[model samples]
Target: MTCGYARAVERARAGSARVPLTRASAALRRWSQRSQVTLTAVLLLVAGLLTVGIAADPDWVPPATFLLLEVVAVFLLRLRPLAVLGGTVLVCAWGLWWWGAESITPGFLAVLTLSVVAIGVFARERQRLGLRGAPGDRMLVDLRDRLAAHGRVPPLPAGWRVDSEIRSAHAEGFSGDFMVAGTRAGGTTLEIVLVDVSGKGMGAGVRSLQLSGAFGGLLGALPREEFLGAANGYLLAQAWAEGFATAIHVVVDLRTGDFTVSSAGHPPAMQLHAGSGRMELLDTVGAPALGVVADLRCAALTGRLDQGDVLLLYTDGLIEARGGDLEQGIDRLMGAADRVLAPGRGSAAAVLAGVRAGDDDDRAVVLIQRA
Candidate 1:
C-alpha cells in the first residue's frame, strides 16, 4: 500500500509540474488558459452541432473524422505566425476541395473569410507596432532630428558682445516664428536675417531649422551680396522648396549707423525711435522669395540707426495675429520696450513678454540696441 501511494504521489506531482506557473507568471498563464478554454468550448459546440446534424444524413462522410481534423487544426493555432499561416492556408485549401464533393454552408464561408481577414489585419498591426521603419517611424525620427537642432548653436559671439534669450509658449514645437542672427563684423558692418519658414509642425519645423543653419553659416562667411545670393540659390535647390520661407537680410553699420536691408516675401521689420517711440516698417520691395527663383536679385537699401535707437525684427505671425487690432499690437510692443528697458536695464524681456501676452501666433523678437 505504501508503494502504491508513492506512485500516485509521483503522478500527481508530474501533472502539477506540467503547468509550471508561478505568481509572476500567473497573469499570462491565466490569460492563455482562458483563451484555450474558450476556444475548446467553441470547437466542442461546433463539433457537437455538426455531429448531430450529420447523424441523420445517410450520404455524408463520418462526422468523427471531420471533427478530428478540425480539432487538429485548432491545436495548430498556437504555432508561430508562419506556421499558423501555412496551416490555415492548407486548411482553407482542404475546405475548398471538400466543397467540390459536399455542400458548402454559408456559415463556413463567413468564418473562413473572417479568419483570414482577422489574421491579416492583426498581423499587419503587430508588425507595424513592432518594427522600426514605418512612415510614422520615419516621421518620428525626423521629429527627433528637428527638435535636437532647436535653438542649438554655439554660445554668444566670442570677440563681439551680445545679448539673447528664448521664450516659448509651446515647449515641444515651434510655430516657425523666430529671430535673425546678427553678428557685428568689424567696426561698421552688422549682419542679420529674420527668418520665417512656411508652416508649423514637424515638416515645416525641420525645414526651418535647416534654413536657419544654412543662413547662419552664410551670415558668418560670405559678403552681404554674395550671402544673399548663395542663400537664395541654396533654398531654390531644395527638393521640396515650395517658395515658402519669407525672410529679411540686413547689414548695419555701427559707426555711421547706416543699415542696408533686403526683403523676400517677409513682413517688414520695424524701427523704433528710442526717445519718441516712433515705429516705421522697413522697405518691403525686393525680389521674390528665396526658393521661388534661383537668379533673382535682392535690392539692398541703406538707412541710419542713430544712438538710443532700437531695431525691431519681427515675423508675420506677430503682425498677422488676429483677435486684436494690428496697430494696437505694434503700439503695445513699442510701449513695452520703453517700459521694461528702464534707464540702466535693456528691455529685451519686456519686448518678448509683451509679444507673448498680446499676439496669438508664434512670436519672435530681435531687439538691437546700441549701448
Candidate 2:
C-alpha cells in the first residue's frame, strides 16, 4: 500500500512536469509562426517594390547588378527591417534619379505606393519587436504605453476591480476597442470608458488615441452628461479637419449603483446581469459621430448595476466582423458574455475575452461591478 501511494505521487509529479513542456512547445511554435510571417511579408513587399521600380525605369540599372542587389537585400531583410527599408529607399531613389528627365510612370507610382505601405506595416511590426521607427511611430509608442497599463489601474471606489487587455491580431489596423477605469472623486463614482474608433490602420489608430485622451480628461472633470457633450465636441473638432470617429463612453457611479453613457456613431453597449444569462443593450441616444458637427448634444443614457452585472462597451468591428454577419458576431459576443460574466468568473478579463473573440477590427470592452 505504501509503495502504491508513492507511485501515485510520482505519476502526478511526472504529469505536472509534462504540462510545462507542452506549454513551452506551444510557445515555441507560435514564435516560429511569427518569424515565418515576418519573413514572408518582407519578401513580398520587396518583390512588389522591385517589380514596380523596374517597370518605372527600364534603364535604371544593369540587370545583373539590380538582380544581385535584390537577392542580397532579401537575404538581409530576413533579419533586419531597417536594412529592408533602407534598401527600398535607395533603390527607389536610384531609379528616380536615373529617370529624372522622364515623367513618373504608372509603374513608378505603384512602386512608391508599395514602398510606403510596406514601410508603415513593417515599421509598426519592427517597433513592436524593438527594431526601428517611422513616421507616426511616436503615436504608436504612446498607444503601446497606455495599453500596457490595462487592468493595472487602481480599484474602483466601490471596491470593484478593473479588468482589461490590449492585443493586436496578426494584422494591420487599430482594433479600435480600448477600456479605461478608475475611482472618481475619492471613490464616490467609478468612471469607465470603452471606446471604438472608426477606420483602421494609422488613421483609425490616431483617432482612437484622440478619443481616449478626450475621455480621460473629461472623466475627472464633468458629470456624465457634460462628459458626453464634451466627447461630441471633441469629435466635431476632429471631424472638421479629417472625417469622423464613432465612439461610446460611459461613467458608472458606484455610490448610486447607476451608470451614464454617451455614444457617438458607436455601437450600443450591453449589460449582462450578475447572476442570470439576461442581457440588455444600453441606450446609445447620443449625437452623430464626433468631428461631423459642432455643439452636438450627446444624450445620456442611464442604468443600474447589481453585483455580478457586467457593462460591455464595444466597437462595430465586433458586430460587423468580416468573417461573419453582424447578427452572428453579436450573438457570438453575447454568448461569450453569458459564459464569462457568469458567477465566479466576474472580472474585466472575462468580458474582454468575449469581445476580443468577435473582433475582425479594432475591439475593446470594459467591466465594472459594485463592491
Candidate 3:
C-alpha cells in the first residue's frame, strides 16, 4: 500500500509538472489561429491611417486607402467580415466629416456604398443560410482534398490503371459529379461509386461534398449487394427539396477481370472489349435514381474486362443536352471513343477533352483500363 501510494504521488507530480507547458502550448495555438490574420489586418489599417494622417498633403495619401483596407479585411477577417467592413466605413466617414466637411469626396462615398453592399450580402447569408466563416476553412480544405483523393483508385496490381477526371459547370471550382473508390479483400477487389448530385457547379457543391464523404465511408463497409440500398437509404433520409441523384456502382475483381455493375437512374456505363473493339452498355435499366423511391432494389449487370479493355463511367452532364435523347448521346460517345481510344493509348482526360457535347454543363469521366 505504501509503495502504491508513493508511486501514485510520483506520477501525480510528473503530470502536474507538464500541465503548465501543455496549457501554454494550447494558448499559443489559439492565439496563432486568430492572431496572425487579425493582427496583420489591424496593422495594415493602422499603418495606412498613420501614413495618411502624417502626410505633407492629405491628397497625396489617396482617398482609396481605406477602401483597399476594407477589401483586405473582408478576406482576412472573414470570420466577421461585415464587422471589419462596418468599422472601416465608419472610420472613413467620420474622418471625412471632421477633416474635409466642405470637400465633396466621392471616393469615400463610393467606398461606403460598396461596404453597404458587402454587409447586405453577408447579412443575407447569415439570416437565410446561417453560415459563418471561421478558421475551419482548414477543415474544408481537407474535405475538398479528401473528395478528390478518394476518386483516385487505390494502386492496382500491375497491368491495371484507373484514370478519372471531373470538371464543374462553367469551369467553376466544384462539380455535381464525383466518385469514391476503395479496395478490399487483400487489394484484389475494387469498388467504386460515380455519383451526380442534383445540381451543377457550386449549386451542387455542398451536396456533392456531403455525399462524397458519406459514400467514401460506405464504400467497403457493407456487402456488395447492400451498397446501393444503404446509399439510397441515406439520401432518402436527407429529404432535401431536390434530393434525388443518379449513380453507377461498380465492383471489380482485379485478378479475374470480372466486374458487376448497377445503376440508379444514371447513364449507362460503357465497356470496350479488346477482342471486338466494340463499346457496349452495362446498365441495369428500370432502376430508380437515389432518393426517388424507398426500399428500391436495383438489378445488377455482370461483365468482364479482358486484356487491353477499358470501362467508362461518367455523369449525365457529359452527354445530356437540349432535345437530346439517351441513345443519341451514347452513340456519339461510342464513335468518339472508337476514334480516340482505338489507338490504345488514350486517357480519361483525353476522352473528356475530345467530347464536345457537355460544354455547357459539368462533365466527369472515369476510365478503368486493364493493361
**Top candidate, metric TM-score:** 3
TM-score of 3: 0.81
Model 2 lDDT per residue over 1-371, tens place: 25643443344234222312234444544554366557546665765565465556557642233344444443334335545544565555456547662544556556655655565565556556433322123335545555434324565554565555554443553545566555667777766666655566655554555455555555555555655555655565443445576666666667667887778777777787766669887767457876677766777788887776767766665567566886787778777777777664655556656566643455555555554
lDDT of 3 by residue, 114-182 (tens): 775776576556434423333333434444565676577788999888888888887777778899888
Write down the RMSD of candidate 1 (Cα, Å). Answer: 21.0
Clashes of each: 0, 11, 0
Please, what are the lDDT tens digits per residue for candidate 1 over residues 92-171?
43554465524345565555555555554544553454321122233444444443343343333223222334333354
Q: Could you arrange the candidates by lDDT from highest to lowest?
A: 3, 2, 1
On TM-score, who's better, 2 or 3? 3
TM-score of every model versus the real structure = 0.53, 0.58, 0.81
Worst 10 residues of 2 by lDDT: 12-21
Which stretches of model 3 miss by more than 4 angstroms? Answer: 1-29, 32-56, 78-81, 84-88, 94-104, 123-137
Per-model lDDT: 0.54, 0.57, 0.72
Q: Which pairs clash inside model 3? A: none
Ranking by TM-score: 3, 2, 1
